[model samples]
Target: MLRHEFHPGKLVAGLSLLTVAVVYAGDAGGAWEAPWFVALPLVMAGLLLAGVAATIHGIRPRGAARPEGGPQGSGKLGD
Candidate 1:
């Protein structure tokens, strides 16, 4: 399996949605009362947070070192 970069944005989004689901589930199970519009702000906040995370991730630079013999480090034009 190929390893991939960790994405904070996705984590935030998932957690936000999970929170909304839990709220509704709790209400349905008679654990507590939840307003119908409760999820609106939560989802909006999640989207905003995810966008910020993604923007920061994209702006950040990767490792400075380049693998030996890789096309990127190779001096020759065109891989």
Candidate 2:
């Protein structure tokens, strides 16, 4: 196991993608109907939300306090 700074943008992006996958999976499994148009909007909205989240996180002022032993000054989104 490992610990690191939590990135909400990434989390939201992942969840959004997962939700889309589940919906299509359900359709494939014959559980329900999911039209092609549904996926287009879903993916676009997810990307928009992810971009907003990342922008928010980037603009947030860095506080004096941070979790001890965390990586510092990585300057990368995936860090």
Candidate 3:
């Protein structure tokens, strides 16, 4: 199972930027206006979602670290 400390600060920052871009885009009135207003939020949301997925995937426990001396299965030459 995977375990991760979920952090929302970065997501919030992205959302804030997205909001600003949306408002700026909204002020520019034209046929191309609404799509531009929406583009930033969509891109920001995708990036943040991908980051969250990566963090969750990375935290899964695999196994113990290797022993210090050498490989585990190799028998001594003259035991």
Structural RMSD, model 1: 5.4
Flag regions of model 2 displaced more than 4 Å.
62-79
Sort every candidate by TM-score, greatest first.
1, 2, 3
Model 3 gets an lDDT of 0.60
1-79 per-residue lDDT for model 2 (tens digits) = 8978778889888889999999999999999999978888898899899989988887755653555445785555775
Best by lDDT: 1
**Model 3 ranges with Cα > 4 A deviation:** 1-34, 64-79
What digit string (tens of lDDT, one per residue) describes model 1 on residues 1-79? 9977788899889988999999999999999999999999999998899889887877755543344566565656685
Computed on alpha carbons, the lDDT of every model, listed in order, comes to 0.85, 0.84, 0.60
Instruction: Write candidate 3's Cα lDDT for 28-54 as tens digits.
Output: 744244544466666677677767766
With candidate 2 superimposed using the best TM-score fit, by how many Å does residue 33's alpha carbon deviate from the native?
0.8
TM-score to true structure, per model: 0.74, 0.71, 0.38
Model 1 CA lDDT for position 71:
58
Indicate which candidate wins on TM-score.
Answer: 1
Each candidate's number of clashing pairs is 0, 0, 0
Question: Clash pairs of candidate 2?
Answer: none
What is the TM-score of candidate 3?
Answer: 0.38
